[model samples]
Target: MPFTVLTILAALLVAAFLGYTMLRGRRSDEPTAAYDLRVYREQLAGVDRDLARGVIGQADAERVRTEISRRILAADTQMRGEKAQSGPSSVTSAVAVIAVALVLIGGAWLMYHRIGAAGFPDMPLSERLELAEELRVNRPSQAAAEEQTTPVQPPKLEESYAQLLQKLRDTVAQRPDDLQGHILLAQHETNAGNFKAGYEAQRRVIELSGSEASAEAYSNLAEMMILAAGGYVSPEAEEALRQALERSPDLGPARYYWGQMLAQTGRPDIAYRVWLDTLRSAPAGAPWADAIRSQMDDLAFRAGVFNPPQLPVASPGPTQEDMEAASELTAEERQDMIRGMVNQLSDRLATEGGSPEEWARLIAALGVLGDKERAIGIRDEALSVFAGNDNALQMIAAAAQQAGIAQ
Candidate 1:
């Protein structure tokens, strides 16, 4: 980019210099030449001094003096005729230089501005000019922007998921009992939504990390296990949730999801109470805040506590037992389960009775069933039901990949 910019600048400079030289050449050929008066007067004085000092013969000095006088008289006549033209021409040249500079600078700025093509496709022409002018006028503001824009240092390569996983696996393979390695593995697995792997890892973390670290690991494992349960509302999910809550009652996500599980299992009143506790105790803007709010509204509507929002209702997610069972299934069995899920989802879509959450559940079920094309079609229709969300996009992509379906 820098080389291209320099090449462009060199071209413009050459053009300007050529234009200035052509103009000067045209002026130089004029019959009425512009001469400096001081140099003419100095030459006349030098002739007079030479004549007085007898450095030159009087006749020779006199002849030279006559020629000089004639040239001075002719110059005075020309200056009188061209004074108005000279002043205006000088001003015009100066204005031309200024104008050319502005044009060159403006063109350069526009070209450079286009370098940010990846991010700002919708920039308007007026906005581009305004930004360029602002940047030129404020050096300090420009400096601040430059500092802000410097590329962020890349995170340590060793900490990356792939590298860390390899290291953890190697350590576990050698020791087969390293708890820290297990804890790292569990965290990675949970993040990747492999809850069974996470559960195994968390067990190792508990063994190696002692009671305090074990408590945290257990909480982490419990949350993921609940997600994998697949809405069956199992006893294991409930027990894990209870243990996690006992360890850290203020964990907002656990509280919110636990309340959701309760609502699913014919305990709306209990769920409503739990959500109320969550709202009061959980920090505002915490990760689970939205879930808590939505769940609260759902439970309240179910218990006839208040009118609900116009948003569509959704079915609860899988239970821990369901996830554990699914994880143990052979690949063929898993495919069968996915196909069954897709059929069920198709029926639900035909009925169109499920709320937005139910529709999302249906979408995910289709992806899991290896019906990427159909899943995307359903997703398009169901998108209006749920507001746009980053997590929703990621989940769809993940499910599609797992089912060996191209997104």
Candidate 2:
């Protein structure tokens, strides 16, 4: 505010100074005809003196007088014309000078008010950085952020699946130290919008993991915490992301979250750099890469990149013909080949139980084949088989969701 006042004052002073100078110059102007007439009189007197002193002949003296007399008559006529033409013009000229001064002062104020920072002092680069750091350190805490956040709606689930979810929670509670139990609980609870419970279960998973924990485990815990806090990165999430990055710096999900945490802490410069590096190494159709791609333009602009480079594209995946060549049974026909692989896998799983992933994959493939009833039956069986293994159950649940049998 003070700066604005000072600016207006300075502009006013300059405008006033210019206007006064112009008006004063105009007022001090003497009539040009009067000056010219005086000079002619002096020449006539000089010619008389020269003639009396015999400095020139009488004819030369008369010729000089004639020229002087002509000039005097012209000057006298101009003076009378000026007196007639010079009345209200002086006042009009003064008014014009004042209007110009007013316009200059008002224009300066208008331009400054339009775009200038009126209250804040000038910010140097170092001061701006310091301000960003201050904002980082003093930002809202996780609980506070959550208090103000509007929660995202959880994925809808059928009542039967909800009952099963409750049973799984009960099962996890009965087996407090079961690593798989907590993993499953965490996944379901988050899906159910019970993020508080989800993050708690996730924390237990991390605790149980101990030294053998992979970077993915830490990242999962961070992701759960971020969701619970409505996307705010609290101190806990920061520590988790740090651990994940330290263990596996190239991990896609971990790097994505790391970039998010950095941006939340007022460091989009570092965040953009981290996200770009992560994108370069991301595999085709990576979910993390998609997340980065959606927000890349805004992040780049915040990081001072006006014309950000184009993002990396995914390479083409294998075609149906390529699949037929790789899997020999596929040569006869595509549909027949798919059924053959599914039947073979089914026969193997029926005799010798497969891993949770294999069971989930089978369930999805069955859904793709449009045998939803069969997919549901298989899903229920898998659920029963992995009742004690929550992590396995969670995987199966996802496949079941894809099958459209349950949410």
Task: List lDDT for all candidates, in order.
Answer: 0.63, 0.83
Off by over 4 Å in 1: 1-164, 213-215, 231-233, 307-407
The TM-score between candidate 2 and the true structure equals: 0.55
- Number of backbone collisions per candidate: 9, 0
RMSD of 1: 26.5
Candidate 1 on 1-407: residue-level lDDT in tens? 45546646875786588558646854453335345455577788999898889899988988988888888888887776665454336567667766776677676666666764433346565875566445434423222432444333333444577677677767787986776677678777666656556677776776676666633455566665554453333455556667778888877766776777666555576778777766765543456766677556657987667854443223334445557888999999978876775576568666755555555666667765556788777766655444476665555445445545534
